[model samples]
Target: MTSKVHLPYFDHLLELLKDQNQTAIAAFGRHVHWGYWEDPSSADGSIPDFANAAEQLSRRVCDAAKITDGLKILDCGCGFGGTIASLNERFSNLEMVGVNIDERQLERARSQVHPLNQNSISFVCADACNLPFEDNSFDVVLAVECIFHFPSRETFFKEARRVLKPGGYLAICDFVPLKFSLPFTHLIGKFLTTSVHNTYGTIKSNFSLSTYRQLAQKTGFITRIEEDITRNTLPTYPLVRKLFRENGAAETEKITAGAELVSKLGITRYLILSFEAIDP
Candidate 1:
């Protein structure tokens, strides 16, 4: 098991699930990331609403990957197999593999998500930066709101490119820092290192949009879609913070509040990016 990754948030979530916390299970049983709302104001801030919004976010990323019937897809950093389950329910005759570094998460994913709609679903315990697969193995690769926890974006890009078939899409959603706000965000991150570590565990949100393009060019991929949906995802913070507070994760709630502040101020933008694998 590749247990090198440290995610205190997941640990907390797992404990909550063990205790049969219905609200926690409803909000994060499947998806462990932020939610997305088409109309930010329409967000009801309820558990069911947040779960639906989270599903929408997964669909948005899958659409960006151009997934279709009978395609083989690899979802890296898959948390509890939420995206995979969504794909299974929507598409047919698809081969989907959900990979996560944490065995605990993978176990939950395997136990919860089953193949449906003529789709095949499997979970693998592996690091995103070091994929355990052959070259040209998948038609589409996805990383949904979990790239920040990766050891190295460049390495993960290379790995994704290696495993993807020719012209395959690599779609990911990440928290990208605005170019001008890099220094300020870095300074703040340094100051809140302990708090952030205790909450999210090993997040690297300092990467900029321009750097993503450059990385794609260097990793034999072409930028296909670069959309900033920060506003669409803003509704997630309040609900998540409320849940964290109710769950007695005060530090986590505080850290999440800080993230919400930066995102609202446009210092940190949530971006959905898709790149096509090209000939090397």
Candidate 2:
């Protein structure tokens, strides 16, 4: 990430999140990523469920990260410990830590901890840009659609690098615009969108795929896998549209539709990038 920072921090949203832990921005309470639907279009006329598809995207991230037994993982900006629960169920001998900026969300995440893995999975309230862990501590750091909310994604990149053991991986799931327009396209997207999730309130989360790749390289990491899963995630718009309507936000329909349309046209992308740590 270049030092010519263009975006602002999300400090103001922290003030608004005191009691919004149970608030479900997406259809599910646990997930917030653009869900991965095998068929974005409802050609078969099957019932669409948001949480189910969101789990698919989580699995995709886990697969790309090659999560396995005996590996320690960090879920940075982990909304409600969904990744922890998912991975804990799949792998037996795994140790996990989940961190969220908000204490309220961290409380909920801590509650999700299983009795069996209570000794293994732990949640901490901390800033992602400044993780509260030692260097070379974890085998992997997974940030699912939450980096954009951080004050400085570059700082978080450095922190992830610092905490990861050599040969460890960083997996990120985020929305990447087609063009690399800073402070402009992202600014407009916030106005058009509905809920004003943590990052959109400050426009801190505004980088395209190309920009992220460049930043990773600049931060001393190797991009091992970059997948554009727009097709798999496009189906999430309808779910978000319903959420906006159910909350009496009638004006967000157009904005949600616009996002979906732009994504289909390749002007926006839902991407999963896996980077491996190496000597810089």
Candidate 3:
């Protein structure tokens, strides 16, 4: 039997198109770092039992989305269905579903989310840029911390619009650059890590908040909120480092150094955006 080999960045995505379910499950199983998915309460040694930041972000995004009961919600780039599980727990009335391009992650999501426990939840492997759902299928479409991987922001916005019902909403949480110069720390980190492919790699991505809002508006969605969560990420960097140290990951040392460098460089950080679908 011939063993499978990973393709290049974009080609890997195309292969995922063959069966989104399998792709998600396989990719997550092989690549995801579960420790990084820490609960916010457990984030810092001082912030005891606080709601997880990611969960809080998910909640805030949902709030920003203004979803109502019986609303069809699509979680684009829903990694291992974390957001889906979070939102479902908070709002049982919502009809929540998630889509990703990795099959391995989808498998974990299915296994973790019991069928009888929350029938409203569903996970499938699908591309974020080109969603497979029919037009106007959902009341809300959310892409949390995942849209950065999208090859084309415009296509992603268009697809989100296509799947969302009139008057529906869209929310995205991702990293954005603060200034023009490429931070040296990142370049150094990349050189240290096993290329961008083997680890959390940056791509031909843009970071300006203005650019994001402009893309959304140009793609036909009404951009609502552009929030700065940089402080949140910076403060919690230590916590993530602690978690990594506890887990004994070799990358812990590098991440700690990188965090310090990031702070010193004065780079603007990650953020979450909210938008609404409006037809002219």
Candidate 4:
């Protein structure tokens, strides 16, 4: 199946994995997102350390969603089923479905993740903004570090609300710009367009926290959690850059460095946000 999105980073990772690159498999075989360290200073910058931190990041989002046993869940943009695997391990009797537009990633996910601890798992290739599930079918919907790649956040939010049962939760992590940074971000985005597209594909990182709240309200949801964990995610940049460099992706490394700079300057914030579906 043809994917609507074009993420070059994933293409590189898949190639490396196919070639039996052990470090690449170890670092990104599961989760393809940034890591979260409880204490940034204590991050040891090893493959194992980064992998553990990545798992922690997924758990943090799940915790925000108030995930419990026996709840039907949908993980949108579920790259390689990492979060689904994590959830399958921690919870029992869960009806879990992972949705991604890219079938290649879903193929790997299907091969790697299986039902465990009485949890059922399935991976579907579908757009985040156009889920194939029935309305009000899921108790929780998660989008971990992938909202920026969606065609439209507003549409995805509306779809998420539609798919969730009443009082169900939607949890996501994203790079949110501060209100004051929007103008500057737009200006910089124009110049970085080609480079960013070549490295990470289309990304929309100009959404501010206030805009998120407005989106939640407009989409029949109430904002529940908006925690900024940018500091904790800082340790991910160095490790990711090193990996990119080792893999001979100079353009990707340069783009990642730029992202790390903006993040360190507080121009962009990494946030975990959860919203509860409400009756309209």
C-alpha RMSD of candidate 1: 1.1
TM-score: model 3 vs. ground truth: 0.74
Clash totals for all candidate models? 0, 0, 18, 0
In candidate 4, how many Å is residue 184 off?
0.4
Pairs of residues clashing in candidate 1: none
Measured with C-alpha atoms, the lDDT of residue 280 in candidate 2 is 68
Candidates in order have lDDT scores of 0.93, 0.73, 0.62, 0.95
Q: Name the TM-score of candidate 1.
A: 0.98
Cα lDDT of model 4 by residue, 146-254, tens digit: 9999999999999999999999999999999999999999999999999999999999998999999999999999999999999999999999999999889999999
The stretch of ten residues in a row with the least summed lDDT in candidate 4 is 1-10
RMSD to true structure for each model, in Å? 1.1, 5.8, 6.9, 0.8
**lDDT preference between candidates 2 and 4, better one:** 4
lDDT of 3 by residue, 30-93 (tens): 2221112233343543332223444566676677788666678998877667677766666656
Worst 10 residues of 2 by lDDT: 1-10
After superposing candidate 1 on the true structure, give the runs of residues whose Cα lies further than 4 Å from its correct spot: none
**Shift in Å, residue 131, candidate 2:** 0.8
